[model samples]
Target: MERSLLTRTMARVPGPVTVVTTLDADGKPWGFTASSFSSVSLDPPLVSVCLDKGASTHAAFTTARHFLINVLAEEQHTVARRFATSGIDRFAAGDMETCELGLPGLHHTSVRVACSMHSIVDAGDHSILIGRVEEAFTSDRTPLVYYNRSFARPASNPDRAEQDIRASHIADW
Candidate 1:
């Protein structure tokens, strides 16, 4: 199978946009936008995020003791784009704060998970970093989503009830 074909197929699968942040050894914050985050375990409360091997922030994150995953809200598309771009000062984009774990976190996100680095696994062209959730926070905002190479949000209609929307189109997958 061609890599491009596989990528295109995966693009159809929607995923929550996230900004994973960590501080380097010198206390300089580093972060990157990702849509490849997922919950791995519930017993120990673990989650995983994958970063491209060539990403500028990869080394810093792989070596960091802790990190925070800020699940972007629909209104935070700019935040997602900023972190995804290369060669930009992501932290300077603003709306960031220090979490209890001392990792940088985005403000007003749908959710924030502060985690301790548990394991790093080398995959084909990326590295998967698994973290043990130490603390988490959630807000009532709608989560930012990525699909077909663009940002998206869950449909909302004033006349349609939440349960109606879910029953009509939302799938467990």
Candidate 2:
């Protein structure tokens, strides 16, 4: 399997854009923009996010006791780009503030999940950080998405209510 091929293939699959933040040993905030955040379990309320092993904040996140996953709103494409960048103060914009669990949380996000580090699993050149969700916050804002190596906003379906009814019927199974 060619790496570029995999990259291109995965790029077509849209994912939620998030900024995962944690405090380092020095209590300084470190974060990176990620599109690989997901729910892992329901019984214990687990969530997982991926971080590149070579990322500048990898060590801080892998060892941090707690972190926040800020699900960026559709209008926050700039915030995603800022955090994704390296060698600059990502928090200099001051959009993030101390929130749940005393971690830096990005404002106006569609969702925010605060979690305690549960475990870290090594996966090739990346590490999967699993967390036990401590709490979550949400707003009415639409989430930002990443697809084809670019930021996108999910389109609203005009027949959403009908779709939901159909989905509810499937849930009855």
Candidate 3:
């Protein structure tokens, strides 16, 4: 199968946007935007995020003892884009804060998962980093989603549409 076919198929599936952060050996913070994040094991509270082998932050994360997954809100598209960009300093803007675990985290996000590095697996062109959740925080804001190569939000009125259908059925009866 062609790579583009796989890419296109995956693009159709929406995913939550996140900023994965970790500290370097010298204590400098590093991060990258990712949509390839998901829960792994509930019993161990493990989560995984995939990083390209060539990503600038790959070395820092692979060696770090802990990392934070900052799940972006719908209002944080700019922050997501900034982290995804290459060659720019991601933490230079001071938009991040130090979590209780001493890792970097983004403010005003939907959720933050501070995790200790559990394991690493090499897959195709990327490396999967599994982390055991040590601490987690969540907000009321809705998550930012990525679909078809663009950001989106969950539909807000599905319940209303269902009510409308119900009302119509009642009228017909």
Candidate 4:
């Protein structure tokens, strides 16, 4: 029941990192690094992100009713760190532009997904915010991966696909 133990256990889980963004009333940008994101439905192009019950961004999220999911490029590690910390201006001195819907979306991301709130469900200590992707863009560039709590790049060789799978086998929880 210790919180540190819980954190350590969760840290062992390798998950892709994301920065969820929205605009405040004054049209300023806001974002936070999140690893708890997943595709919900393909037919509707839905995705989901979980937010801490007490996250400072929660109120803005509820009011904005719209946001974008920027799948980070590996080069965006600093962006991740910037948004993840508290009491920091996440978009300060940044080059992000407004989306078609006026939501703030980061440029040069692996992908930019503009969405509206589809629904919200309460979990144990978080809320699963489901979003209907109204639009999306995928960069021609490769994706940024995360594993064992670190950022990673593509394996590069498809001929080594078997080797990569085998390597993952040894590290299976």
lDDT of each: 0.93, 0.95, 0.94, 0.81
Assess candidate 2 and give its TM-score to the true structure.
Answer: 0.93
Worst 10 residues of 2 by lDDT: 153-162
Q: Residue by residue across 51-106, what tens digits does model 1's lDDT show? A: 99999998999999999999999999999999999988988856798874888897
**Clash count, one per candidate:** 0, 0, 0, 0
- Considering every candidate listed, which one attains the maximal TM-score? 2
Off by over 4 Å in 1: 156-173
62-141: candidate 2 lDDT, tens digit per residue: 88999999999999999999999999999999889998999998768999999999999999999999999999999999
Which residue window of length 10 is worst by lDDT in model 4? 93-102
lDDT of 4: 0.81
Q: What lDDT, from 0 to 1, does candidate 3 have?
A: 0.94
Better of 2 and 4 by lDDT: 2
Worst 10 residues of 3 by lDDT: 98-107
Candidate 3 lDDT, 1-173, residue by residue in tens: 99999999999999999999999889999999999999999998999999999999899999999999999999999999999999999888888988848988877899999999999999988999999999999999999999999999977798999999999999994
Ranking by TM-score: 2, 3, 1, 4
Off by over 4 Å in 4: 1-6, 162-173
TM-score for each of the candidates = 0.90, 0.93, 0.90, 0.83
Task: Give the per-residue lDDT of model 4 (tens digit) for 20-42.
Answer: 99887787677888888889999
